[model samples]
Structure formats: structure tokens, C-alpha cells
Target: MRPRILIVDDEPQIHRFLAPALTAAGYDPLRADDGASGLKGIAVWSPDAVVLDLGLPDMDGKAVLEQARAFYDGPIIILSARDREIEKIDSLDRGANDYVEKPFGVGELLARLRVALRQRQRFPGGETVIRAGGVEIDLERRLVRRDGEIVKVSPREYDLLSRLAQGHGKVLTHKELLVSVWGPAHVHDTQYLRVFIGQLRQKLETDPAHPKLILTEAGVGYRFYSP
Candidate 1:
């Protein structure tokens, strides 16, 4: 079956331009013009992913994210006019899987969606073992080890760490990790990521505060430092 996507934006033109492109890209697109409407659509459509806008008429994007988390498990990519570093950080902190500023190329958006969804599929199913920085993630086994010693992790925590390790040192945006590990519904729950990252660092890093393995990218994302 073709993947379904929800596009939640207040602007009609945003939908007009991207919906057709999404169709061409081999996905179904559902449109919502405002936050309240978007939530309603999400409840009814149950899309595989969502392209969300931060600035909505009746509600801010953060609240919508909160609501979505309460009910849904899917990927959410923020498409918004807000481009400031602080805004991006806040959005990531709030639980978006990825963020794209307005006037973005449709192709780029599609590629990001591909990455998010692919990673999501890797979570519920099995994945190959990943080794980096003395940590071995046996994804298929759902086990993590440091220097051959088994490392304890909850199911969600294992999924989160495995995704980062699987990224192979590439930076993973907050939303990408959130959605991939927690699903589209949990994409906006950034605190969950932060808290669990801290827990993982405590177990994996020689020094949590001065981490040499799980590196932060300030306004962008996190990377599993390899080599």
C-alpha cells in the first residue's frame, strides 16, 4: 500500500503546491488548513507521516504536537515560516522529527520523509547489528553492549540508541529520531528524547557531560561520534 501523509498548514498555497508533488512521489496526501482542523484530520486519516506548520490560526504548532502525542504514533516533519535557530531548537525540543523552513523544495521534503519513514520501519522490525565507538548494537537481538559487556536499556531506549548508532555518525534531527523510535504520534515529545539520551549517555559514555560518543549539534541534531 502507498504511504499516506498529512499536510497541516494554514496556507492554501502550501497545500496546492506540495500535495500534487506528493502524489507524484507515490504517496497519499491529506490536507488541513489550521491546527484544530489538522488534529481532526489526523484523527480521521491516521496518516503514516505528517508535515506540520508551527504557526497556525487557532493554535500554535507545539500544542498540536502535544495533542498528537496523546493520540497518535506517527512521523511529524515541521514545515514552517519560523527559521530562527531558537525556534528550531524549541520545535525540536517540543517533539518534531524534522523541521523545514518555508519555500523549501518539494523534492527535499520528500527525501526527508523517505528517511523518516524508512527509519520508522527499521524500529518495529529487525535491523542489522551496528558497531561504533566500542558500542555494539545487535538490532535484531535488541541488545546493546559496551566493550562486550551487556548494557541495560528499556525497549524505547533501545530503539532510540539503535537508531542513532545505525545513523553511522550522520547527524539525526530530533524529530527524525523521535518519530522513528516513538512513531509519528510521539514526534513532538522532545523531552522523552532528551531524557533517554541522558540515560543512554550514562550507560555508554565514559563521561556523560563531556561526551565523546553521542555528540550534540546545537540547533540541528545528535550524532553518534564514530572514530
Candidate 2:
């Protein structure tokens, strides 16, 4: 079956430009110009992945993401104009998997979407355990342990940490983390990411204020610092 892709943005030009690209890349396109309508479309269409813009009318794109996560478990690619470092981190923290800045290349967006789809397909049979930095994540069992000690983490927080650790010190931009974790609808909610990262620090870091594991990339996104 051809993958279904939803594009949620307020700009008509976005649909015009991306719809054709998505179609050419073997995806059925569903377009929404606002967050509320986008959420409804997501529930009804249940696309395989989403391309969401952070700046939307009615609600911030992040709220749409929070609502979507209540049911959907697909990839979300954030398409936003926000260029600040913190803004990108915020989106990733909220559970987005990947993000793209505005005026982005269609090729890059499509390529990342393909990557997200591929990753999701690989996890279909409930074999979910990730190990890195002395941390072990049994996603199917909802358990994380370091050096034989179990660590408690919220669902979203664990997802974030897992993705970062999986990257293994590779720099993931805010958009990339957001789309991968949160489902594309929240590629711009930096505040949400900030709060959760803080919580994660408290639980995992020896000093939450001076973290060493979940390392920041200055102006990009967060990464796992393997020692």
C-alpha cells in the first residue's frame, strides 16, 4: 500500500509545493491549514507520517501533537520557520522525531520521511531493547536500567532518552528529534521539551543542572555523551 502523508500548515503554497513531491514519492497526500482541522484529519485518515508546521492558527502545533499522541503512534516531521536553538530542542522534548526548517529542501524532507517509515517498520514484532552508555532500554517491557539499577522514567521522557542514546553522540537537530519522538505535530514546542529534559536530568543526571549524559549541542539539539 502506498504510504499516506499529511501536511499541516497554514500556507497554501506549502500544499502546492509538497503535495506533488509527496505524490511522486509514493504517498497519498492529506492537507490541513490549521491545527484543529489537522487533528481531525489525523484521526480520520491516520496517515503513516505527518509534515506539520509549528505556526498554526487556533492552537500551537505542539498542542496538536499532544492530542495526536493520545492515539497515534506514527512518525511526525516538523516543518517550521522557527530558527532558534531552544525552539528546536523544545519540540524534540515533546516527542517529535525530526524537524525541518522553513525553506527546506524537498529532497531532504522526503529522505527523512523515508527513514522514519523504515525505522517504524522494523519494530513491528515487539522486539524492543536498546542498549548504550551503560543504559539498557527494554521498550516492550518499559524498563530502563543502568549497571543493574532500574531507572524510572515517564513514557515521553524515556522515548526522548532512547532516541538520543540510539543516535549515539550523533547531533540531531530539534526538528529531527521532535518528528521522531512526538509525531511531527510538535516540531516547535521548545517549552515542553525544556521542562521534560529538566525532569529527565533530575532522574538520570548526577547533577540535573550540570548534565553530562544528555549533552546539549549548543545551538542544535541534544545527544548522548558516551564516556
Candidate 3:
């Protein structure tokens, strides 16, 4: 069966443009103009994937994303005008699989959708083993290796690395990382996250000063750019 793609956007033109593109790509396109309708459609149609917009007339798109995540396990790609790094991080950390800013090319949007779907199929219930460049992380076994050599890391370091790796190219905010690794009380501890990120880069990057894998998004957070 053709994959069903639900597009939740407030703009009518988006539907007009995406419906044909999804059809041409051999997928069934479904539309919802607001968060309420989007949530309803998700419940009724049970689409294979979702293309969501952050701005909805009835509610914020992030709320829709959170609601969808409550019961839906399928991939969700956010299409929004919010280009701020923090917004992108918030959406990803909240459960969005991908984010595409507005004024985006149709080709890029389609490509991102394809990638999210492919990743979903490739790693179903989350990736247990992530291989990027020469680094291999077996989450289940709690093992880390680089260049065919086992790499030793503290329990906290491993926790930090796992959180970054799980983001899958999504930027993670400092608060999000701190909360995930050091618990809720550490959410405001930016220094702690920075120190650990520095350590992670030193271990994972070929050059810690000019990192290629673990990247700092300047005032935002970090993204694990997997190969």
C-alpha cells in the first residue's frame, strides 16, 4: 500500500502544493488545517507519516506534535516559519523527527520527508546501534568504539553521548541535555553541559578544536552530525 502522509498546515497553498508532490511521489496525502483537525485526522486516518506546521490557528504546532507523540509512533516532520535554533531544538526534543523552515524548496522538503521515513524504517523502535564514520555506539550493550578501538567513557559521558546520538542530526538545547543526563535539577547548569560536550567532542572528533561530528550551534546547543 502507498504510504499515507498527513500534512497539518494552516495555509491553503501548502496543501495545494504538497498534495500533488506527495501524489507524484507515490504517497497518499491527507490534510488538516489546524491542530485540532490535525489531531483528529491522526486519530481517524492513522497516517504512516506526518508533515506538520508550527503555526496553527487553534493551537501551537508544538502542542500538536506532543499530542501526536502521545499515541502515534510514526515519523513527524515539522514545516514552520520559526527559524530560530531554539525552536528547532524544542520541536526535535519534544518528539518531532525532522524540521524544515518555511520559504523552503519543495525539493528539500521532499528530500527531508524521504529521509525521515527512511530512518524510521531503518531504525523502527529507535536505533539500538548507531554507526557514524568510524564510531560505533551499541546502546543496548552500552559500548562505544572508534576506529576499531574500544573507547572508555565515564557513565555520565556515555549518557551525554547517547542523548546526542539519539537526536539524529537534531540540535539539542542545553536544558534538554542537562535534564536528560543530569536530571531536572541540573536544567539550568549550562556549564555542566558545556564541559561534557567538550569532553565528548575531544573523544569523538578528529580535531577537538575544529570538530566535524559533534558541533556547537553557538548560543544554542549541539548537534551530532553523523556520517
| Best candidate, lDDT | 3
User: How do these models rank on lDDT, best leading?
Assistant: 3, 1, 2
lDDT of 3 by residue, 19-116 (tens): 99899998999999999999999999999899999999999999999999999988898999999988988887798777788988889988877766
TM-scores for the candidates: 0.65, 0.63, 0.84
Whole-model lDDT per candidate:
0.83, 0.80, 0.86
> For model 3, how many clashes?
0
Predicted model with the maximum TM-score: 3
Clashes of each: 14, 22, 0
| TM-score (C-alpha, index-matched) for candidate 1 | 0.65
Clash count (model 2, backbone only): 22
**Per-residue C-alpha lDDT of model 2 across residues 1-227, encoded as one tens digit per residue:** 99999999999999999999999988999999999999999999999998889999889998888788888878887889998767676676565767789989999999878867776665543457765556677767778887669998888988888777666444576677777788789988766667877888787777778998887766677766554
Which lDDT tens digits does candidate 1 get at residues 85-155? 77776776566677788879988999888877876665544448776668888877888899999998999
Compare candidates 2 and 3 on TM-score and give the better one: 3
lDDT of 3: 0.86
Candidate 2: C-alpha lDDT: 0.80
